[model samples]
Target: MSTATPPVSGKLFGLFCLASYLLSLSYGSTFLLSLLISSRGGNEHDAGSVISAAMLSTFAAVIVSGHLSDLLGAARSVALFGVLLVAASLGFALTPGFGHLLLLFGLLLGLGWGVFYTLGPIIVASLVTPTQRAKYFALLSGSMMTGIGSGPLLGRAASAFGYPVTAAFYLAALASLIGVLLFWRLDRQLKQAAVQTTAVSRISWRSAGQVLSSKAVFPIIMVGLGGCVFGGLSSFQTSYAAARSLDYSLFFLGFMSAAISGRMLIAGFVVKRDPFRASCLLSGLMLASIVMFGFVVDSGFTYLLAAVMLGVGYGLTYSVINGLAANEAPNGTTAQSLLLFSLSYFIGVFGFPLLAGKIIVEQGMGTLLLTVLAVASLNWLITVGRLIWRRLSTTRALQRA
Candidate 1:
């Protein structure tokens, strides 16, 4: 009997292409979205509101996306969802004014992203073997980060290319269009028609309800809070750098490179060791990194060091949480659980950036960075509390035994 598993050459490649291209476009659209709002004569407050609204709407829809995905299969749902997002994104680009921007950001992006974000992971999980999951996930995450890190730069280049906001949308559309095609190709291979009926039969209300009520809920909620705090650091970083006479772009790029490398390296190691302990330690490291970011008085090397620390910390901590969330998923609640965890993160994403903006506007960017550090510290505290509880429980159980 052969113990070796076959490599997912054709199908997985197709899926990776889809994920990479789509996320790249999406990230570009993110930068363009911010710029578009600014170009339309909207102030910082208005921009924050628009972005926050889009994210909140996306978060709400993620719940539905997850449930529906398991009911349907992961691949078909993702394909259909991607197409809808393409249309919505294109429409947003074509629309004339801020009202149209509101319509797209508030509605289309939300619905589209909710579905896309929820299903993307499900599809990846479906395609790979359990043994390959760690490597696959790390690579997948790195690709998304690449897209994100390059997004604004691409958008700027696109704007320089002459389409202004329209160019960004076009780039985004092309990315999604490519994603749609890649998935469509893979759909031909991986999806089994006979299993569709069996898949639908597996869906259960009781299972979902049980999931809704669980001891794990509180811990999951903290993941969301941590996400917001992490995002807040990015929201305030550039502005903070300006105060310290830093080269913002260099510091930013250093963080991005470190983050990508960290995710790629740390993910495999964590899977080999104990995931639980690894994640908690990484989360603590992220908190420490934020503190480093907070106190950097020098712009030259110190700022770069701070960004790299933040990158490494987030790379390990945030990526591990994603894997843990996958492990925690219930039988039928694969998509739902995926979205639920993401839902919290996105909510934090939407709110925290705005919160940072408010602080920056009212007090200063330094205040906003402080806010991120404070939130990160809280995340560490919560993680430590959980660790302490676990140790105590283990001691008691051993004593009783």
Candidate 2:
């Protein structure tokens, strides 16, 4: 790989990471918008509907935007999405009515978020050697975590200062704009570097279908099943803490910090070795963690242990699956494969929360957790089964020889 393919400069890549962090910060503010809705005579139903809408938009955008990124070029696509993000953030700050917030937060912001995830990896892929991909992916994932972890804290601070909840949106808009400016500068720098670039294939329905149904892409999607397990945990951790008389903040702190650390520290090793084995091991840990959450209710120590276990497990899972997917990108179809990976991931992220929420209401936490356990256990079983089958086939071939 040439040294000048757009992402070589440490400063430019750092800026890209900053942009990712800011985009996620804006996304995190959406979690605090229920208060704004309540102040306007709206209810949790409205908030749920808005959130569901955003998830739907995010799903659709990931599918379409990846193809669009291929056609329009990564720099242009990212620029367009960044502009939409700026507009959405401003709308969030200025829109007073619940309906408008739905449009801005649900549809527009979701579009921007989808585009950001789709392009970030594709751009990074173009910039680095194959060996370095996993490390950078780990770094970008950490950047996103930084934004997610910090956004809520900032929202709390704004409330402490007697600022209306809308202030969070304003701050998000400012951060987003700064991120956009940095992206624009990076785009200019890429052009100035004069790297050889390939022309992306024009997208068609047939081409999209072929990419989606390709064998290389299937494992990538399967890897994303872990996200369903994670979404369930994220959606109910606060309630779980309350039920057990534990501190929600402390539980989350352990979970998110451990997840971030695992991605940064353990992901490189996983990607360098057998990703399937890593997947099986980490998923077993996730299953164990969920079991702890369900049955162990004695002390805060259990909460800490479960959260950290879950975090480290899923964190490594996230990085390994992404690195594996990126490795499968054939020539001009990198964006499309990544889109599938993101789509499968968000399906779990969005779908499982709703599923788990309903199950919790109808049955109980015990049943909901059992459901998570079943899904996670199945994931581990499939990976382990594949590994065993591969080893058996290799041994048979050796005997024949």
Candidate 3:
């Protein structure tokens, strides 16, 4: 890897981390504001819907924007996305009514995030090689963890600052705006003629299908959903903590800090030894964390335990899944794969949570959690079964040859 790539010099990478940090911090703190809606008297579905709306909308936009970045180039797409994010933040600040404005903000923010979500990783990948990916990925993931962890602290800051509960939304928007400026600077550096670059194109559905038909990529996708399990679990931690009377903000901080540490601090160790085995091992760990979460009743220590377990799971699953996504990027399929990966992840993050919300409503949070555990086990089982089949087929082919 060339030292001159993105000039990780003098807070260049720090700025990239800052951009991501704001994205997560702003989004995570939304939970606090969501609680306000409930305090003012909203239903479970109402809050869930608002959260889901933001994720779902962002999910849709990211898939589209990510592919465009490949066709258009990471720097250009990033700067463009930054501009949209500022616009969306302003829109969010201006929306007056409940549900109505919430939905509109959701759309605008989603658009901004979609562009970013797509471009963030893509740009990072463009900067580093596969061997160096885990470290960079971990650093970026760590920033997100910090942002998530800061949710409660930021909420407290919001209060002391004498801002409205909705003020957190504007603050998040502000952070993202700052990120835009940082990314614009980075973009200028990346576009220079002196920087050696590789050209890549968007993957078409036909080619993507061909990649999917491959023995390795297909299995990776199913196994890849393990990444989503961590995502789904994180989605519910706020309610789980609050039900136990834990400070919602604190719960976020603890959970996020652990996860951030896992990614930023611990991920390199796992990646250094073996990215493939690390990935497989993380899947097993995620299953274990969910099982523990299913049975634990007292949160005094349970939340911390669960957070650590979940953090490890997230760090493991994401570290590998991200590498796999990068590896699976067929010669010209970078954007297409990114789009599809975002779509798959969003489905897991947004769609699974919506489904789980129903389970929470009918059976209760505990039951919903048990269901998540079952889903994790089941998802893992399916992956194992596929891998077993693939191994056997490979053995047979070798014998014939």
Candidate 4:
């Protein structure tokens, strides 16, 4: 056989997509954990804290995983995260009390997810050119969304066996293991084929600083800010549905389905054309979703529409942002650049919900919705300002020339 690496065929790419889906299926518990905590006598605030804790831990892990990705290589780092997921899952299955669940569910699960999120895209980016990046990214994102959509259903089904909450974790662990194996096999095949992948001797604060200083930093921050709404929705959407007397699962289905449709059908075209424009649209949609939630008064149809809008907006936004960050990755520093992107993501995920949890406890979901809407609107305005600034600069340069 030729020593050259085999080209990534459509079939191989499809399998990778499948791997993405399986990996994401593990996230179904993200929505369930809050309810689990609440059911076990932890109040809504405490349940929100669990999500906040997990996201905060994820933020920390993404920062560390950047360096780890450089040292260990993307494939090995991903496998390591998978191992963490397995351990965390087993821990969740066996934990006897709330404190233990916090560690297992909040910390370890966050680490696993953080690494998986950090490296999976780098792996895919390595396999494609800058031009093909957005499309492939959308596919991977769509796959993950598919998994996220199915995760709750999986957890619900697994719960039928016994110990419903624990069963969800157990099932997630099993599914995560399968995903790891699939990814590992793909990695081995790529290595055997001698395909080049991201590798570096060391990464540190210095490298991260370099990325922070780059032009991409502003857009990355905008993308991350958009996630604040996502963080709020993740922690509260189910409860919000409950308050409105809408079916939680049904609402999520509409949301996830819209998100998937946006990614698979619409993201490629919009992101490829102008990521910034897509980001603006996504932020606007998020703001609208929050507005719908804030004003909801027993209209199931209105609630479902809001969910769908949130899903489509977030779905398209994430794919575009990831693609933008990937495009900005300076030679051999792909992982570090991506880490910056991940950091931005979890900042919103960690900060917004934590603060909103407090607001929800004190003021109510209405106040929380207003907060998200305000932040989202600000983010959109910032993106639009960036676009205008770039245009004005280009115009000035032309005049000077």
Candidate 5:
């Protein structure tokens, strides 16, 4: 029940980062689940459905795991989900054909992702001083981005060597298992050091309600919008590339490269100063990138350019929003606020693909891009609006005084 922040340890932080990277690599490898569905005779709709199912499962998992973390402790909760993730990856590799079973595996995969993704930030928040959180958060995100970005390239390499794409799933399983072990070690170290984790003592509807209505709502909404843009683009990049006679890997390469660099080098400095204004600028960049991708990206060079812009824009924007969510959280409700943040983001990331699949099937990729562009525009507008509102509110309060 103590509210004091735990003392940071350099060794434990490194272990957490390594585990996060490996776990993210496992999740990122599955980004190509659409290809797996195709190989098994499933179509776009089927792929979308499976992905959405996983996302919804993630949504549920975030809520459930938040409570479980409080009860069982962060390390145990993470390990349990990590085991589920490993099992799901193995199942994807070994499953004979795509069917309802694939949906089941997807759900399992999502459940694992929800836990790790939510808890990773909580652990970092506990480890770092408030003044250092922005840098550390960006660094943590950079580690995750590096792993995620590498996953698709690994799949591409396997394909280049004429290995079955499914072979990547086996690698994913291995990465996840390693992540679990790393977390286990981290837990032991924390216990030995007697580091107090950020886990809350209890969760309740009243606290959840307060978090929902708190300033955290702004970041939650922004992240959800960003999630929609990310989900729509990443989930369907393969199809879009094929339609344009481009390699899908280019998108991942450019996006991950820019995103990683920005998080590592740029995000901490800019975002920590004025997160709201930074979000607005980055959101504008994201909108421009989407516009270029949707309307002007004909050559591979242009495609990569758009992807890079998106990487800078959305990637940095996400980190800023994440920090905002944590900083703006009401006292005693950081865990719940972050839980909602994860849930909102999952909804957009996993939910949009279902609609996007339908749009691609009926209206084509052009329509899909336009829709995503619209979402990007809306996200930017919201960012700008929130910043303006906050300034006005501050000015009015001073006037009243």
Candidate 6:
């Protein structure tokens, strides 16, 4: 196989971005899964458990997807997972009760997400040169946020039309089907461009494990913590809003809007500078956003503002840290680094909700928020520590010279 880097094509990249948007939209609609659980006579805890269980499958998929991509090729792997997502979404509509829903969504939908999320960036990395990677990554992130951000609106629109929440599942299914076809088309285009060679590689477990080096630890931890905050906030927003008589959609709208804009407008500038420092600043924003959501958000405006702060904070932070993860990888380990990054992130994203759900049920949203606040603060402190450490190391090296 030719190992030469493929020339980048704008049209191919555009197709990839469009597919990402649709795939994410399919996944994002599940942001309202908690409401479905409620309608099924389940509580917050059940919602958390089911969602977390589904995420467990996502975790498994992340691990398997690298090898799958290596074996079947990236585009084919993505298309395969996309098919699974479609089946899972349709299953959500046809399944009778909580147990069936759990089995289908948890295993199939979660697995699809794991593969899609993990491979999307790897494919992008292959398509772009190092100089163009950051900008393209930001654009890809923006496209995904647009789709994810639209998910809540899709659910709301369904309800407005008197369709049950399950209707959103069918919509997700449709989106996934379209996304799959796009990936298929992209695969054909890639073949014609001769960039198809860039997509296939042999990835091993031992190679994937190399991402655990010291350089990657900080970003991994920070993204994981961000996941915790996101998992808790997004997973239970329905109950949180209901308790306050506010609209949950405000949070998603504000979050996606700010996150998408931040990546488009600010991420390019920030990613070019000191990532650790930028991450520290963004962490502070995350901290404030959590506090605002927990304590200060009484009205819809406050809620939206809090979400926007979070969008600016976590959203941009994610991109910066992701860049760090890819950049800091030991040479030849970019794929492994990204896979590990996604795995760590899913752990926090899916793991926390299971716990937060119980906390919301037993102790209320206040306690959950406090817990998330602490996690965010720790993430900030760690980034600051990493920054300080880097500076000190540089100073010592100069002194030695």
TM-score of each: 0.83, 0.84, 0.84, 0.89, 0.94, 0.94
Better of 3 and 5 by TM-score: 5
lDDT of 4: 0.73
Residue 91 lDDT in candidate 1: 71
Q: Model 6: per-residue lDDT, tens digit, 75-160?
A: 78898888888887777677766774576566787788889888888887776666556666788889988988887788888999
Worst 10 residues of 3 by lDDT: 192-201
User: Per-residue lDDT of 1-401 in model 3, one digit per residue for the tens?
Assistant: 46325444536677778877776655555455445555556545555565566666766576467456656666567666666556654554455544656666655555666566666666666666656665776787678667656755665677778976666667766876676676666775555421224454354569568567644364346433653465455556656767787644544555576677788667777777654456556667778878776777466667666667767776556766666666665665554565666556555655565566566667788887777777677656654665677689899999999
lDDT per residue, candidate 2, 1-401, as tens digits? 44224346777778778878887777666655555565777654455455455567777677667567657666667667877677776776677767845654567767877778767776766666666777778878878876765655566678789998778778887887787777766775654542334355234566557666664464565656786887666655545655677765555577778877887777766778787788778878887888888787568887888889988887787777787776756666655666777767767765566567567656777888889888888877877886898799999999999
- Candidate 4 lDDT over 1-401, as tens digits, reads 22122246767778778877777766656676656666666655775676667776787678677667667666677777877777776675576655645654667767887888777777777676667777778888898878877766555566566657667777777877888887777776645432455565235778777777776687578767877877777666667767777767766787789988988888767875776677877778877777777775367778778889889877887887787777775666666787778768877875677787788889988888888888888877876887788899999999999
Supply the global lDDT for candidate 3.
0.62
Q: Estimate the TM-score for candidate 4.
A: 0.89
Winner on TM-score between 1 and 2 is 2
| Each prediction's RMSD to truth | 3.7, 3.6, 3.5, 3.5, 2.8, 3.1
Off by over 4 Å in 3: 1-10, 66-72, 83-97, 156-164, 193-198, 201-203, 215-231, 386-401
Clash count, predicted structure 5: 0
In order, the Cα lDDT scores of the candidates are 0.63, 0.70, 0.62, 0.73, 0.82, 0.82
Candidate 1 residue runs with Cα over 4 Å from true position: 1-7, 32-36, 67-72, 87-100, 129-132, 156-166, 192-209, 212-219, 235-248, 330-332
Residue 240 displacement in candidate 6 (angstroms): 0.8
